[model samples]
Target: MAENLPAGWSINGNGAEKSWFRRFEFPEYARLRRFLDGLAELAEATGVHPDNIGFGKDYANVSLTVPSSEEEQARLGDFVSRLDRLFEEN
Candidate 1:
């Protein structure tokens, strides 16, 4: 299941059923802020919230969960794909 996640994301074995985690690094706080803001907007628009989102001066972490249903899995995949795109854009 972890094999198919986006480039930098990985499954969190310590988490409940369907959890994925990813951390990103930025050159500065401004860039990190932009990434986090965009990610928050994306999550809100999709009606899915990551379980955790941590940000520092130069890095950020996000954890996402989707229940084990087919529809939820599809939604998760789409969400991650959009996330990856957003990462590239910013």
Candidate 2:
């Protein structure tokens, strides 16, 4: 499942406890805030939310559950790609 992760993402745990994680960094607080806002909107739009989200003044740590099925893995990949795009845009 780790192989399915997008660039800059890592896998944690194993089996049912497996998850994908990424840390996004921003040059400033305002950009970080904007990225977080975009993340919230993405979750709302996709009906998929991160299992854990931690943030500071210039960074956010996001963790998302890794589903076992291929279909779900594809969905997760798309979500992750969008997250990467959000980071780039912000």
Residue-level lDDT of model 2, residues 36-73, one tens digit each, is: 99999999998889999999888899999998889888
List where candidate 1 sits over 4 angstroms from the true fold: 1-3
- Candidate lDDT scores, in order, read 0.81, 0.88
What value of lDDT does candidate 2 attain over all alpha carbons?
0.88
Quality of model 1 by C-alpha lDDT: 0.81
Output the TM-score of candidate 1: 0.87
Worst window of 10 by summed lDDT in candidate 1: 10-19
Candidate 2, residue 87: Cα displacement in angstroms equals 0.4
lDDT string for model 1 (7-88, tens) is 8888775435557888888877888888888988998899878888888799888888756677887888888888888878
Highest lDDT model number: 2
Best by TM-score: 2
